[model samples]
Target: MEALFLPQIQQRNGCSPVQPAFPTKVYNGHSQETIHLHPFMIGPVTDTKVSLTISNGPKTLQLEVDLHDTVDQLKKRIMQERKFGGSESISLLYENRELKSSETLGQQNVKNQATLFIVHKCNGG
Candidate 1:
């Protein structure tokens, strides 16, 4: 009987080690069958930008943004454009629900030409 030694697999970046689908046949310190490993590929990002209308009181601001942008990113853009002071906190609302800072616009279903209400708050006295 011949002894087969498998290579040590290590986990990276908190991800689990990849497990083989089935047992591999090893012969004379070499794999008898060819093991094809394909690199993980991510799909290309689209350049499509959605137009969003932000309503704050009687004033409305038009913004064109990518769907992948998070709510915090959008708020930063608004702050830049409006020259909002650091003391002001901005909140975005869609359909009466507050948008989460960590969530993307696409995840929240904020489509093109969508109207988002902006609520402003002063941080301190």
Candidate 2:
């Protein structure tokens, strides 16, 4: 029998395991610049932590949210903690990136001990 290798699975976007190519840039000697690139790794299936930082009025509060939930569910938890109404809007940021309400915590590809930024909506006329 011939040896068989497991096929590489594709991401949700249907893209294969294609490597990213970085183009070289030439800069003037007098100018100084810094370019930072973080390599993305395929994380294991594990329980992740969701942290939140909120700006309510003039104070900032930080709290931890459970990752076994959707973004909207987390918002409900925050609302309860802050004693805010259920209709109050909120925002979730993952890795300094913003996520929509329809998105879930796991769908964002967050790993263990991930820090999520929670911002309560402050509406002013």
Candidate 3:
């Protein structure tokens, strides 16, 4: 079976996951300046408590979940708690990263005390 992996970091769009998507800058030895991406990211998905603030439109939901759970599971829980019928239309965005359904919370680099934006996917022609 394929391992469920989520993007780790603060993407232009925000979402949830095990990795913490904080941005980092590296300085080159030469006078020339350059920006670089980190090879890996991390999150606080351990025994420690992780709090997430989910915002959907005018409504805001605060959820606490285990790091071991999958992102899809988190979506289900959110839909159940919010009484949202259209789970298919929902997507979790945090720090510019869109959380994939097949990935786990740890894969997405979701960190403690991060704010997630619950938005609907746009339809295209």
Candidate 4:
């Protein structure tokens, strides 16, 4: 039928697939599987709260961080707790994920009580 061939031709022509006016979701794999995600938040600063969780480590701490704080500040806080040196490399994780150095908690959409994991980065050459 024309309808069947039209989609193929459109694909060959590099045309985007037709989308519904309203948002639609299609599962590529494990469509029937249901996932339950626990909610968390980031805190400490008064302004700009983020909802995230840090489950990267065995022990999890729930707190809020101010978006105004830079990645360096966060590292410093973690260092104070762990008592690491100034030159040591530290990284932050939001929702069990790594955060880009340039990104702030506010920019990344973090929320209250979001668990953030602070880890040290090891370099060997």
The C-alpha RMSD in Å for every predicted model, in order, reads: 9.2, 16.2, 17.9, 15.6
Q: For residues 50-124, write the lDDT of model 3, one tens digit per residue.
A: 788888777778889876678788888888885544655678898897888888776778898888888776678
Per-candidate TM-score against the hidden true structure = 0.57, 0.43, 0.55, 0.45
Per-candidate Cα lDDT values, in order, are 0.77, 0.58, 0.69, 0.56
Off by over 4 Å in 2: 1-68, 83-87
Candidate 2 lDDT at 1 equals: 31
lDDT of 1 at 49: 87
Instruction: Compute the lDDT for candidate 2.
Output: 0.58
* Candidate 1 per-residue lDDT over residues 1-125, each given as its tens digit: 35554464444565644556544334554555434422343698565589999887777888899999999999999988874445378899998899999999999988889999888865665
lDDT of 2 by residue, 16-48 (tens): 443444233324445443233233557776546
Q: Which candidate is the best by lDDT?
A: 1
CA shift of 46, model 2, Å: 3.9
Kindly list the per-residue Cα lDDT of model 4 for residues 21-76, writing each as its tens digit.
42333344544432322223356636565444444357544445677666666666
- By TM-score, highest first, what's the ranking? 1, 3, 4, 2
Model 2: how far residue 40 lies from native, Å: 29
